[model samples]
Target: MAIYELRTYNVIVGKMSEVVSHYKNEGWPALAKHPQKLVGYFTGDVGAINELIHVWKFDDDADRRAFWAGVYGDAEFMAFAAKIRPLIAQQQNKLMLSAPWGPQP
Candidate 1:
C-alpha cells in the first residue's frame, strides 16, 4: 500500500507571508528537481492560522526515507530550508494509508 506523508508547519506568527515567499521563490524550485512525490500544498485561512501543510506519497517506508534523504541532502533545498527554519514555530508529520474503500489521491 502507498504511504502518504503529511507535513504541517506552523509558521511563527506574522511570518507566514515571508515563509510562503521563500517557498515559492526557492523551496519549490529546488524540490521540483527531484522525483515527483508531492501531492499538493495547503495553507489555512480560517482556524489554525499560519499552518502550512503539504503531502507526499511514497511506495513504502524505504521509499519515503530515501526520498527525504535525497531532498535533505541536496545543497539547494538545504539552503531554502535553512532560510525558512527560523520562521517555523513547529512542525508535525504523520504517515497515513488509504482507507479500504474510498477515493485515493
Candidate 2:
C-alpha cells in the first residue's frame, strides 16, 4: 500500500502567480527527475486564498524521505526553491492512507 501526502502552500498576498508559474515551469520538471509520484496539483478556488495544493504518493516513509533527499540535493530544485520559498507564507502537510474498501489509484 502506498502512503499519500497532501501538501498545501499558503502564499503571501499577491504572490500566487509567481509561485504557480515557478512550479509549473521549473519545480515539476525538477521533481520528475526523482522517483516520487505526483497525484495532482491544484490552486484554491474558495475559502483559503492564494493557496496551492499538491498530492504525492510513496511506497513508505523511507521512500518519501529518500525522494525528498534527492529533491533537496538537486541543484535545479534548490534554485527553484530559493525563488519560490519567499513567496510562500506557510505550508501544511498531511499523511493519509487509503481505505481498504475505496478504489485504489
Candidate 3:
C-alpha cells in the first residue's frame, strides 16, 4: 500500500502568492523527476490565511526517504528551497495510511 504525506506550509503574511508562484514555476517540475506521486496542491480559502497544502504518496518509508534525500542533494531544488525559505513562517507534515474500507486514490 502507498503511504501518504500531508505537507502544509504556513507562509508569512501576504507572501503566499510568491511561494505558490515559485512552486508552480519551479518546485513541482523539479520534484516530478522523483518517484513520489503528488495527490494535490491547495491554498487556504477560509480559516488559516497564507497557508499552502500539498499531498504526496510513496511506496513506503524507504521510498519517501530516498526521494527526499535526492531532493535535498539536488542543486536546483536546494536553490528553490532557499528562495522560498524566507517566505515560509512554519511547516508541518504527517504520514498517513489509508483505512481498508476507505475510498482509495
Candidate 4:
C-alpha cells in the first residue's frame, strides 16, 4: 500500500517571513530537482498560525526512505535546510495510510 507523510513545522513567531522568503528563493528550487513526491504545501490562516505544513506521497516505507536519502544528499538542499532549521521552533511528522472509502491525494 502507498503511504503519506505529513510534515508540520512551527516557525518562530517573527521568523515566518524569513522562512517564507528562504523557501521561495532557495529551498523549493533545491527541492525541485528531486523526485516529485510532494502533494502540497500549506500555511495556517486562522487558528494555526506560523505553521508550515507539507504533504508527500510514497509507494512504501523504502520509497520514502530513498526519497529523503536523495534529498538529504543534495548539497543545495542541505544548505537551504541549514538556513531554515533555526527558524523552525518545532516540527512534527506523521505517516498515514489511506482509508478504503476515501478519495486519495
* C-alpha lDDT values of all predictions: 0.96, 0.91, 0.89, 0.96
lDDT by residue (tens digit), candidate 4, 37-80: 99999998798899999999999999999999999999999999
CA shift of 70, model 3, Å: 1.3
Q: TM-score: which is higher, 2 or 3?
A: 2
lDDT of 3 at 1: 78
Error of 1 at 95 (Å): 0.5
The residue-level lDDT of candidate 3 at 58 comes to 88
Point out the worst 10-residue segment of candidate 4 by lDDT: 96-105
**Cα shift from native, residue 95, model 4 (Å):** 0.3
> Which is the winner by lDDT between candidate 1 and candidate 3?
1
- lDDT by residue (6-100, candidate 1, tens digit) is 99999999999999999999999999999999999999779988999999999999999999999999999999999999999999999999999
**What local lDDT does model 1 show for residue 40?**
96
TM-score of 1: 0.98
Q: Clash number for model 2? A: 0
Could you tell which candidate, 2 or 3, scores higher by lDDT? 2
